[model samples]
Target: MGDFAEAVRERVRRAREAVAAAHEAGDVYAVAEAREELDDALRMARDLGVDPGAGPEDEHEDPR
Candidate 1:
């Protein structure tokens, strides 16, 4: 992956972690914030020629 893709990956990873933590803590606001961040990250990934698939594995493994 290129530098920007790698940076996006890190953002995605952090967003995922934030979502998980927010869920575990029962923080609705945090969850919403994290989801928005994740969604933005996914969109950015797609714009950057990455496939935002059904799951993270698929996203990274997309042939195109």
Candidate 2:
């Protein structure tokens, strides 16, 4: 359980970094790809009985 959680967290962190880099580069396609990756990570978290909205960024904003 701990290892799985760590993997999920790592994926989320990478996806976020990709999104930021894509946005900085002004690459729409890359941004979309990164968003998809982020979504997938969030879904994984949900499947593990975790709340996707539990992240700090999620606290102040609605994903949709």
- In model 2, what lDDT does residue 54 have? 49
Residue range 8-56, candidate 2, lDDT tens digits: 8788777777877887788889888988988898888878965444452
List all candidate RMSDs to the true structure: 6.7, 3.6
Q: Model 1 Cα displacement at 61 (Å)?
A: 19
Tell me how candidate 1 scores on lDDT. Answer: 0.72
* Model 1 C-alpha lDDT per residue in residues 1-64, reported as the tens digit of each score: 6777778877877877787778778888988898799878888988888654455434554111
> How high is the CA lDDT of each candidate model?
0.72, 0.73
Alpha-carbon TM-score of each model against the true structure: 0.75, 0.76
List clashing residue pairs in candidate 1. Answer: none
Give per-residue lDDT, candidate 1, residue 40.
88
Alpha-carbon error at 31 in model 1, in Å? 0.4
